[model samples]
Target chain A: MSLLEKISDQATTLTPGERRLVENVIDSPTSAALGTAGELARAAGVHEATASRLAKKLGFVSYAAFRDALRDEFIATRETATRFEKTIAESTSDTILGELAREETQALGRIEEFITPEQISEAAQILMRARRIFVYGYGNAEVLALLMVKRFRRFGKDTHQLGTDPRGLAEQMLGLDSDDAVLSFAFRRPPRGYAALMETAKEVGARTVMIAGKSGALLTPRPDRLLAAPRSGDQDAFQTLTVPMTICNAIVIAAGLTAKEESLKKLDRLGQLIERFE
Target chain B: MSLLEKISDQATTLTPGERRLVENVIDSPTSAALGTAGELARAAGVHEATASRLAKKLGFVSYAAFRDALRDEFIATRETATRFEKTIAESTSDTILGELAREETQALGRIEEFITPEQISEAAQILMRARRIFVYGYGNAEVLALLMVKRFRRFGKDTHQLGTDPRGLAEQMLGLDSDDAVLSFAFRRPPRGYAALMETAKEVGARTVMIAGKSGALLTPRPDRLLAAPRSGDQDAFQTLTVPMTICNAIVIAAGLTAKEESLKKLDRLGQLIERFE
Candidate 1:
């Protein structure tokens, strides 16, 4: 914890008077309390000159040091808030409907943070023209790849998943030529051989895109494009890729939107077929 | 919950007047409000106007706004000082330590926000020398075929993964070729495929690296090096890779460190035995 957080905890546990003193100056500047201990004491409902005394109790030699603690707290709190807010901008947790209003607000923030006409146009163009397009990944990405495959099939692209296989995978790659495009979803660590494939895909003239982490440029040697998630490696665990995944899905949808009228009609038909079959 | 965290939450239940109002403000902007108008009013010891009165709620709106309704209470409470204190330092919940005194103080404050030099080097080195890498990705990375396989083992490198046939996943990928590397694991929506192969080891690979999610990257990429983890995806009733599954475990720890010496020593021993036995 930063000094501010420490002070906050210590302040709250102390006697009301001392706690009051701790609270007021916790976010204050060191200079604020030095000569004005009397003023701060009055403001906090403590002895007129208690600020310095409280500082001493808290282990600071003078009110100036306490003020410094407060300033540090303020800054740390600010930084944390900004980072947390950034994560929330993209975060999509389950069953947060009760927060619809806030959710909408946050959504807007996210949209503004990233959406650009160039991005929409480019992503859309890629989706529209991708030949032999494949959304390759494992885990959650498997489901996403399936969805993309289904979505793109309506546009008349021949897409297939790289199911669990070793030799078969090699054989499959041998069939592809430069005209094909693959959207490989290896965000964080980029899988064992993921980066190697991007290198090969490019060698084979296949267009590849990466949606990944805030680490070494391990994966994308030949990536035609890269989308760095708003949330980096830091907040990954406490939070899942709920935020970035949603953003990527939206990109797919946006790309679909730009794929033109016939594509939408085709999608409807495809959905109808799949629905009927189910 | 860590001791630090429990106390952070308890800070909110405090009476407004009873708290070091300034310190609470610095700690959490929305905290002073209890999310209920009456509760907020009661907590702050003020009328609605007085609560609305402190509109500079610094980080929040009026006290009325902060507690009007719970949108994502989880969001509000999730990232606290303790959580940030660790993750920013790259110290996450994967380990069990939560000691406040022993905590890495500068880790959070000085977090790289991006990847660290050490992490990059470690991941890169892992990928450079894999003899044969077999990646097993069930749900999300089903399409990761060829992506990981073709990437690492490019130019005839022996990188492999589960074949499309789920049944052959174990035996096929485990047939280590020339100091093989096993990169098999599951991701969001864990598949039975990975769980089945968890115990197998590639005779060819020198070492193993396992990457799992917050929940075991849904079951660690078995046999070795672990990367970031546990990104479960739920888009509909189905959350597809909320985080990129394949990429999450894509850490090439071999980028910097070389367990090659030990691996080579074992490989040499195994090769001689295989030659003599065969």
Candidate 2:
């Protein structure tokens, strides 16, 4: 069995501190794989001894052995080439499309299981109250950042997308203030500039919201509001954006609904402008 | 009962030609509402009289009356304001998130019912053979376009996103050749540069593929390959990106799987580059 499976198998017997460490390990495997036992305990807000106890509880010889196994498991499973090979080996060309669709559909169906209505409402409330919204995402996440900026702007919020380049990002960060909010998308591991952006937002007292994968729960300085869920597939498989995109839509809709009258008026004006121009 | 309901109810009695016209109307209500009977018939590749016959069969006094009702229904049901209002009226603030999630889940589940494995393979095959790929989307669709460009590039395809601006689009189109492919996303209606993009691709003999809503089935000078499905919710609700994003993911995976070895090599190189840079 995998390290995570072994950890979960012992869930009922773990002490509170041990349980906290176990949860942190599962939530951020990358950190668990890369960090020492003390760092893991500190990040999980637990006693250092809990990590070694949890390791023994899971039948490992020692804490170092447990860490070695975890690092090995992480590297073996998450290498992009290994993951892609597994995906290709599991399905022939004829079945790949159906398999992917099924995976994504199942993922979409599970959104409510991982994300709560309360979390969405909390994030939306922050978005509704912010004077301006700056979105941060990189790689595939950037597509979502652009999407959020466009949709939020349509709902009458002042919105901007932060560039991925460090220089441009620093320039943009200069404009943030207490009245603003930062909405970011992160999956798997946090992106470059994530720490700087979060620190700047904190420095300026801006409300911060993040839509991310489960790993987001372990972010050192967590956002003001977090809506985190697992993506559609195993950590090793190619994941789709369906789940996160649904969360984004829900957040936008919820925010718009929070101030119904004003949102509708903005949409009405948008419709008129489209009709006039197009 | 709604006009669409009436048409479906009479499905058993429709002639082949009448069925064609009904399908066209169901697929592209905007066209049915705004176009003349002859134009609608021609678009559906049916006899002009078939439009009138379908109208009469649906209990309308004349084709013009049918068109008028369709126009009214289309406008009343599809206006952004009306749709947003309906969404707002259907649920309390507490239930909106769950409701939207449910709607998107249902839509994602229905993807296989609308699209076929063969269609995905055909699109993927085109992508595999293309020397270059160009993606076009405007407004919200631009998000999907950006996503396709980024992912396809990762898989080692020469990919570019077609700008929404006419002058820039024309400049980009100048580079198209028979070795290239153009992929577009259109929902509700074709975007501003769609006609020119399609025409230019045709002139350059480039392969063309479109992922669109049902309305795309009737695009004049239709693309060489079309993968069309309905967005979540009715015609007017604030649609989420879940469905289209899922399709985009599937296409990307399918295309990569078509030439697995090369794609894996590219991904490995990407990983190494990331390891070196970080």
Model 1, B132-212: lDDT tens per residue?
A: 556666544544443445445432456666764665765585465555555544443355755445445533435554443
lDDT per residue (tens digit) for residues B136-225 in model 2:
999889999998898888777899998899999999999899999999988878889888899999998999999887455546557888
Q: Please provide, for model 2 over A161-216, each residue's C-alpha lDDT reduced to its tens digit, 9 standing for 90 to 100.
A: 99999999999999899999999988978889999999999999999999998688
Model 2, residue B58: displacement in angstroms?
40
True lDDT of residue B260, candidate 1: 26
TM-score for chain A of every candidate model? 0.50, 0.60
Q: How many Å off is the CA of B268 in candidate 1?
A: 37
The prediction achieving the highest TM-score against the true structure is 2
- CA displacement after TM-score superposition, residue B76 of candidate 2 (Å): 33
Candidate 1: Cα lDDT at B92? 30
Interface RMSD value for candidate 2, one decimal?
Answer: 18.1
The C-alpha local distance difference test score for the whole of candidate 2 amounts to 0.72
Model 1 residue B266 CA deviation (Å) reads 34
